[model samples]
Target: MEFILDTVDLEEIKDGIDHMPISGVTSNPSIVKKTSPEDFFGHMRKIREIIGKDRSLHIQVISLEADTIVEEAHRILKEIDDQVYIKVPVSYEGLKAIKMLKAEGIHVTATAVYDLMQAYFALAAGADYIAPYVNRIGNLGSDPMELIGNLQDRIDDDGYDCKIVAASFKGVEQIKNAFNYGAEAVTAPYAVLKQVFANPNIDKAVTDFNQDWYSVYGEGKGICDL
Candidate 1:
């Protein structure tokens, strides 16, 4: 399973890659607005440097038309690298764009997916990754896990090469459930992922273990010191 970071913050990206099993980095316009980098392409290049070409970097296109979306995807590849995944929303125009981009052998990630039909359409259009809005689906009184489960079944039964990269998580449980429902990947904020180790009992257990070790080896001493 892939644990992708969903932020544009350089420090968060660095810390996450350093401390966790981060597989890739994903960003949308809103996420970019948070950082508001002076040079957009330069900032993305820095991110590519941090993660390296081995990891995926997903960048969304702002164009609403299929022609412009294709143009933007080409420009993003030119500005960044060809390895960058072009994130296009799963709309009528977006589906068209996905087909066009895929025809050129460009990586395409279908974002803003909220329904099974949208995902099916994207899958048929050759999207490398289909992003379903987990929390947003739940907030709309629909079961997000159901959507994920059905999508996974389709991908398995149909033998599609696509992956479900679930997004829009509000908490750790949402991310957990996304994986449990058969999502191959889930992108969440660094803060939400960090909460996995935020339990007070975890800290308490570590403190108790250290205290027992100190009682025998003296405080502030390591095994190497012996």
Candidate 2:
């Protein structure tokens, strides 16, 4: 499974990549507003430099119309490298944009997917990835895992070359459940992902191990010192 950070914070990106097995970075207009970069394209370029070309960088389009969305996709490709995945929400017009971009061989990620029908439409339109809002769906009184499971079944049964990249998580269990339900990847906040290591017992175990090591080798001495 792939773990993607759904934020545009520069330091968080660097630290998350350094510490965790980060596969990519994802950003929406809201996420961008959090960082409020002075130069948008330039900041995205900086992110590309940090993550390198091998990893995926998903950037969303602000336009709502098909023509403008397609235009925005091209501009994003021109501004950032061509390898960037253009994130289009799964709307009526967004599907049209996805079809056009796919025809031109541009990578497209369908976002803001809520209904199973919407995801199916995006898959039919040739979206490379379909992001279902996990927590949001749950908050709406629906089982997000059921949606993910059904979507995965459709993908496997139809032999679609699309992946389910579940998004909008609030806690770590939700993330785990997403993967358990057949999500190939998930994009979550760095702080939420870091909570996987937040249990006090984990810290206590490490501290005890260090104390025992120090008792034998003395304080301030590491294995390298020997």
Candidate 3:
């Protein structure tokens, strides 16, 4: 499974990307707001600069109207190139907007999906990616793994170019669940990604290494292992 960093702080993400073992970055309005309550567009500009023109970046559009979303998609993409992915919801307006964007060859991620049928419908609408939130499904006491399995097989059997992006991951177990089912990508928080390196054995190894490393080299790699 490919890893995507779920963060809006471009500096933090860029600083860590070289060693983070991630392929890309994901940011919604919520994550953007957390980064700066009053200047999302400005933050996005900084992000584009940090990532450069050819690197991939996922940015969610806030418009609920098809026309507005379409317009926003073009504007965001114009910031760089095709590497930019516009995230739209799975509403009727979003479907229309995504189809239009796709027709123009813009990468679209259909978000806010909660069911297997919704994911299928998004692919039918020609979305390049479909994001199904695992934490949301699990909060309703439903079997998210079952949905992941079903969608994985359905997409593979149909040979759709559209991919499944497991979103809103809660922990390493959830990440592993999606990976085991062959999710094309996973967008999880810094905390969740950082947590993946933290098992009892891993922690013991780290503790032992830290103690032995200073004697051998006087410093560690300064990487955030946990």
How much is 35 displaced in model 2, in angstroms? 0.8
Question: Estimated TM-score per prediction?
Answer: 0.99, 0.98, 0.86
Q: Highest TM-score: which candidate? A: 1
Residue range 1-226, candidate 3, lDDT tens digits: 6788889876668765766867777899888777774666667777777766655689999999999999888888776455788999998888889888888888888898888888888888888888999999999888777888888888889888977889988789999888888788888888788786667998899789887866665565444532
TM-score: model 1 vs. ground truth = 0.99
Tell me the TM-score of model 3: 0.86
Against the true structure, whose lDDT is highest?
1
Q: Write the per-residue lDDT of candidate 1 for residues 31-104, one digit (tens) a residue.
A: 99999999999999999999999899999999999999999999999999999999999999999999999999
Model 3 misplacement above 4 A: 206-226
Which pairs of residues collide in model 1? none
- Per-residue lDDT, model 1, residue 59, is 100
Q: Model 1 Cα RMSD, Å?
A: 0.6
Compared with the true structure, all predictions reach lDDT values of 0.97, 0.96, 0.82
Task: Say what the RMSD of model 2 is.
Answer: 0.9
